[model samples]
Target: MASLPQALPEPRAAGPAERPAPPPVARVRRRRRPSGEPPPLPRQLRASGRWWLGLSALVLLACVAVVATGTIRYVDVADTRVLQAIAEIRSPALTAVAEVLGLLASDPVLHAIWLVDLVLLAVFRRWRHLMVWLGVGLLVINVGAAMATTLQRPRPFEVEVLGEWSGFAMPSLPVTVLAALLVSTLYSLVPPGRKRTVGKWVVCGLLVLTAASRLYLAQDHPTGVLAGVVLGVATPLAAFRLLTPNSVHPVRYTRARPAHLDVSGDRGAAIVRALRDQLGLVVTDVSPFGLAGSGGSTPLKITVKADDTVRADESCVFGKLYAATHVRSDRWYKLGRTLLYGRLEDEKPFQSVRRLVQYEDYILRLFSDGGLRVPQPLGIVEITPEREYLLVTEFIAGAREAGEAEIDDAVIDQGLGIVRRMWEIGMAHRDIKPANLLVRDGTLYLIDSAFAEVRPSPWRQAVDLANMMLVLALRTDAERVYRRARLHFSDEEIAEAFAATRGLTMPSQLRRMLRQQGRDLQDQFLALLPFRLPPVRIQRWTWRRAGLTVVALAAAAIAAYVSAGVLAAPL
Candidate 1:
């Protein structure tokens, strides 16, 4: 395993005239394409399921229109002639093989494949794929039933019926269901690559064999099999491609975070170009930095090439990469918090990735301007418009996490002073956990201002104070931390801070640390206070929360029921 790269070098004292000059930009109208590498596939051609979906819809509409106009008799003649042609060459051995191959589209086989899909998706924790699969199944079932009843086209009358069948055969339900099951499995389970390309041919081959068997046996019209193939395959393929594209919801067999995009190929090159063009920084390498500790965004330590213009001390910089996936994750997380805690102050989801990064950038500048010990805000780099962004800031050299570093009186005072200053500025670092607090040369610096908010609720500010104290006490003791906190916070304020702090109020990292320490840190801090206040009520119920709760419970119940049935259904 490779070691984590070093942090950004500390800035050196320099005169204003020595500011780094802008990087030289070369304008190329149409640079010759690189050799050997294939050109990028267009998005529409890459994810062509939506085109197939539209084609299927048009074909279905044409069939329905022909039926409404009483002109389907002409299509039936074509279907009958095709069936007769297929039957002309049918022999016993061929028929036996057709029957065996046809079983691939049978209910039991389709059901087995469906169940296997459900199992694999569930085992992989792909809730999105599972939900879409279930939705497609329900859609196919309802649509097939409706078409059968409405069209009411019987089996081919021109040829003797040779095989067992049931229900109106205008659109073969078995074929439709089979196509859906196989296509969904291909998109959901198989990764997008050469294997998927090969899987497409296999899917086409299976559908052709099943349709041919039905036509040779006189069990379905040619038109009916065509309709089934269109409906079954197109629906789920379009849904999967549209909803869970491989770019975002990749089929990975690793424990890596989903929001972290690969920054090795085109994206890495894009980042380098964007940083140079937008922020006037020339990068040398863009390897992932501190990925093991980061869960929300991709933390990158960019290495800049040091030249006469660029100082050696400013070679490295820190950045957090934000993209559409992080925006969705933020929305879901905020929604979950709102449902659980009844909108605890500014829980609205961000509208876009741009806004999300903009808010953090604004907060970082706000803190830096207000004399907070935060990283100096460099700037924001646009990797891709509206889809991705890179927030650049100063990286403190020789900094260790506050929890891992040795703490003393000065460190404790600095930590308490940060909370006090935040209260003074009417801002709160909503996440005051150990990870966000960095200690360098006995100076505590606050990072990850993504969760910092202005004019935050008093409860939120108090919780910050409590969380900070808890973190400070992790290395020191609660008694000593409280003794120092009094210098910054009054007795009443300290009581209120502890009172506002509770289970969900503290950050998960803080709570987990306290739990692992096996000590009632909150209680110990409260004991040192002059007086105890009643525990603040954190849960507040509202109609909105109640409705969301009901919806969440209903969705979970449905998922459980479907999963159980899929597992128990007989093949």
Candidate 2:
């Protein structure tokens, strides 16, 4: 809302020696932009990974065909020469050192390193990276072994084999396993950028030491080690870059919540650009807002620069970022609720990020048009196509949560009035918690309409009323709130509200707050009514739920078996 004053040209003396003064330098304020280019989308990473995979496959196949056909006589001669040269310089000390290096590349040592990496990934709760690591290991081991057996290549000829030997020789298994393990560890454990760049050189040095040791001991043909390194490095590198990309799942040791994304770097710049291009609003600043009370999406406070195209009074807007991760979280949440209580008033997951943001924007417009005290919708901004979006709304300045605001007769009436209006419009704010309700200047406003539904079930509407009453009572006594609520609804309706609502119906935030009050607020409200009704049954068994349960159990069993093998397998 404020700007720096521009510098003006200084007065010059009127003299023959004084030439035309140069124009005054403009004072430029450099905004802190992210240092590097914006991160590639998930689709871009996957595409590049597939390219690497295809190239590796083609190279490996060509090497196999050349060796199997024996069409290249010069290649065999070259391999023999390298082994003879190593034998010529062999000494007791060199042999001892070579034996130790060979041991380092053995199955037992390599498997031990692999198990340690698995444990670390599990401890960090990097489940996606863990899966990719295990998959790459299993793929290289099983597929490499099969290929080696089919080729049936023996150890180097005309050289004394000084190291341990295994089935076949071409495409050595130890080299492949080592390459995969080291690459996976670097990507999964080490954060990208400078540290990862330094790690690449370190890994390359170790890989070279292992490959050279194998050649010196005459354990396998030189060509075998080349193929092993290529296959080993490409598979896991591609998998990690494609699956657990640094842009999405960063490897950091911090106590920050996972649901809240870091908006200080490329994402911050993207948000500013998206607002300017998509919504014609110049965002001057973007930062986290009310993260403690939000868990579904990143809450951001956006500062818009005032200009001719935009209203001078329009300085800030509230935005919530919805990404692919949030979409998955929404799916998991709906799936869990559906399994717990079958078809609890259309618990269906959104198909993508676009739909999720669109739904909230539509609901906000719908409510504002219906003359409800809600934030005015400002349309949605596209950040990265359907992968990410920002839902913009008017920032209610100088407002506090209903729980923090002073509760009075007017506040009580306003709280009840919102629920009454929703009922009239055949809609329901399924999440009616203290955090979702804001009050300012003797007026109450509702936020977070992501869960609001049109033509909601009567049971849902009743739950909404009950939750609103509970939230209002947290700041005041239940008896006073109920007496005020009775003026707008009949006693029978109040009884049905209590009957339809239960512990599961209330949002988690509201439930925890009620627990801390150290009293049964729900029971207190129900006692004020004349008669009670039977509790409504929310849980209903359905075929889809039964199938989901069976599928979940099967997946768990498979994961358990794999985990046991990874941890307890014999070296």
Candidate with best TM-score: 2
- TM-score of predicted structure 2: 0.84
lDDT per residue as tens, model 1, 400-472: 9877899897888788877877787789989988889899888888899888889988889989999999999
lDDT of 2 by residue, 1-571 (tens): 1222231221111011222222121113434324464422223555646766776788677767776787546666778899999888888998888888777677678767887998899998877788888898888777778778777777788898888886787688778778888998999899878999999999999888888888889987887788788888888988887676675667877876666777877778878776775566767789999887788889998887654555543467889988887888788888878778886743778999999999999998777766677887777877766788889888876789987888887788778877877887778989999889998888788899998999999999999999999999988999998988877677777889999999988999999998888879999988898888899887677888889889988988997787676545431
Deviating ranges (above 4 Å) for candidate 2: 1-58, 64-69, 72-76, 99-105, 307-314, 563-571
Model 1 residue runs over 4 Å out of place are 1-58, 61-71, 89-93, 139-151, 308-313, 343-346, 383-385, 551-571
lDDT of 2: 0.79
lDDT agreement with native, every candidate: 0.79, 0.79
For candidate 1, the C-alpha RMSD (Å) to the true structure equals 7.6
TM-scores of the candidates in the order shown = 0.82, 0.84
